[model samples]
Target: MRNWESFLRGLLISLVALVGCWLVAGPTAHAATSAPQTPTSPPTSILGINLTGGFTQQPIDSNVISGHSVTLSAKGTRNILETATNPLGSRKYVWWESTDGGSTYQQVGTNSTTYTFTAPEVTKDTPLMFQCEYDFTGLGLFYNEWSRIATVTVTPDRVPTTDIQVSADSNTLYNGESTTVHATLTPDNATDPVTWTSSNPSLASVDAYGNVTAANTSSTMDGTANDHGTVTITGTSNGRSDSTKITVGALQNVTVNEGSDATFTLNNLPDGMTVANWYKVDDGTTTALNSTASSYTVSKTTVGGDNGTAYYATLNYTVNGSTKTVNTNAALLTVNKSGLLSLTAVPNFNFGSTDVASVSQDNTTLENLDEATSGSNYDGNDNGELSVMDSRETGGDWTLTASLSPFALSDGDTGQLSAVILDLYDPTARLDENIPATNTATKIYTSSDYDGQTFDVTDSQLSFAADPKITAGDYQSTVTWTLSVAPS
Candidate 1:
């Protein structure tokens, strides 16, 4: 019986030790399985938990088109709950949209890890941004997730009204001359590109690539001149477009005149153009053209030798891809090789002011008038000598003094005298009185009276003129007398 008791006591002690070991081992294993997972290190305590997540942001430009949207996403990372059995207790996600480029955030979505935002309207040259946040909480621990702010830009796709510009705002072309009509498209915003086109194909045509060509139209077209036509050009860029109209014409009336060079200039011409003269005539000798332009003169060497008249040539120009002509007024000039005496008068007389003086007299004639053999000769055929004099102030009564010093004055020896006054003070000054004892006073002079007549000489008088209210300090005009000899 005593031996049985001893064995029972030993067995009981062994059973107690085994139960203690089992309890401790079970608890240790459970703790290992339940602990939070950390990539860097083991958790110091199971009670403490830490979680981390990530968010991604995509910029959805606030200025994008109506159908466009921006996206933002949150990704889970460094999850404290490693196993499905140990999941977080709660999850929260928030998304925000910012119209002011993320300056201020407004809630757009909640309770989601990802969000997509779309803009309603966009302004030109504006910026936009968006952002989101995620939170995870379980077992008395907090996890945070954030997304980088997404950014986008807003811009207008439509173009505003714009003005059309030309590379050469003005152009000039002669008959049969061709030039490019360079038109440029301009947008209200300098940053935008432009498109160009033309309206009137008959008068002028323009290509999409900004090339201008010429067209033909009869005098029958309405709103167009008998010899001229108009072309319309349209320019568009973005959503805006504009049109411009230009006129085209022909050199209807061209003529030959006496000029320094063989060149002639067109009158009433289109912008940015010059006149070119072409003369084809069979002169006894070959004809040479003048050096100066705007008008043409027969070559002094060829004028008298040719019996028949030379006709002026036509002028042509291309504007905006179409041809236009410049009309020149007809001017008939004849060169006489015979030596003759002629006269021309240069008058500088003031009817309003009492200060009157005769610059020249009637016997101012030129001798030996003939066609010019040399260009430098002043008194040659087409050229005449110029004799000038100052106003003769001989008291209140002005007298025209003329002298035939070297030659006798004959009935047919005609001459002209002109007077010019310097510094005409008041162009509006009235005639003080007629001078000299005659039925009707032949001469009028400047008025000293303040209560004199006023005249409108804005277009007629020179720029250096005082108001009608005359001042004593202001001087009258300087007297300049000129003499010109005409072909006898």
Candidate 2:
């Protein structure tokens, strides 16, 4: 009995200990029997995004001469779960460009899936680099690694580098003339057009198609003398050029009277002319004049030799260190013979009522009777001019004289009015030579057209001066005109 009772007490103590353990461990066992749960993927990582679909390698320019342009595109596929709430932020792409072999970078595109790039003017082999970046902004604004770099090769335009030469049809041209010029390039395949220019536009001008026209150094009309010079023409093409030279010549003519000085001139003497000579050709003999200037003159006494004598001029010049000579056209000379001398006087000049300190004039009519003969030896026309005619057999230059008697009024008062001076003008004098103070036998007119012809002194004028104390009645004066031959 004592042993059984001890075993029972031990059993009781063990049971009590088992119940206390069950209360503590029952919740732990229940927690372990629940359904299995899936492992978490760390909130679908938004970082480490990837970009694709752009130029993976360098592209060569095909149309280099004109220019080149292309479109570049990129896409973001991974880490795009945030695109539904923020489409722009999740799939955003940025483009970057590098022109100096990636030494520097520049942002070229943003907030888009694609981009376009245009190259600047490239004169040589040029390289360009491009890349793209993907962004995920939903979770702390994350960015993906940059895309693989893309390269592009651009070519440049072509330039000309050949030589050009030019030539003209004529190296020498006269004023108011033109010639055509031509140009030649070394390479026959060159397509560049040639341009022309003149060193002296006043001396010569050139047109676009290479037509060269001669111009005058001085500002003169086309058909006048003294219109000439020299000029240089140049042609250019493709940065290359050449030049040529041309010369222009001058021309002229002259004439003179029998007993007057005759002069000849080289109208437009060209440059480099060292000397000039004048020559007279008579009866097949050439005589050199004593003058070496551009102009030569012959005296009146030496010019009355023949009716038709030829005179010419020659110019000496240096061309490329060599002496050269050029001749001008011949000019003709004329001489005439001496004839008779005569004159006619106009009627008395009468002044009507004249006041003191007043002036008046009267014209007379005078005609040369010898000048009325038909078929005369004179070279002047019958223009009714006041003239002196020389018809003497031993004829020479002649002159006409006028003697004006003192003016007297009808009242016969010899006062200051009577001493009034008379002046006359031969309106038809050869060189506007006039006669003044007609109180003495003053020479009036002279003529060298020695012929038995008539000349009219109808333009003669007589004047009267009135003093304060002189008479105021009608006054009259007589003018006596006479002619005499001039000594040779």
**TM match of model 2 to true structure:** 0.23
lDDT of model 1, residue 426:
26
Worst 10 residues of 1 by lDDT: 41-50
- In the range 242-290, model 1's lDDT, one tens digit per residue, is 6655544433322222121232233554333444554433432223343
Error of 2 at 424 (Å): 37
Error of 2 at 305 (Å): 1.4
Q: What TM-score against the true fold does each predicted structure earn?
A: 0.23, 0.23
Candidate 2 lDDT over residue span 78-129, tens digit each: 4333333335443456677677777666777778766765657766767676
Report lDDT per candidate: 0.36, 0.50
Query: Which residue runs does candidate 2 get wrong by more than 4 Å?
Result: 1-251, 301-306, 334-488
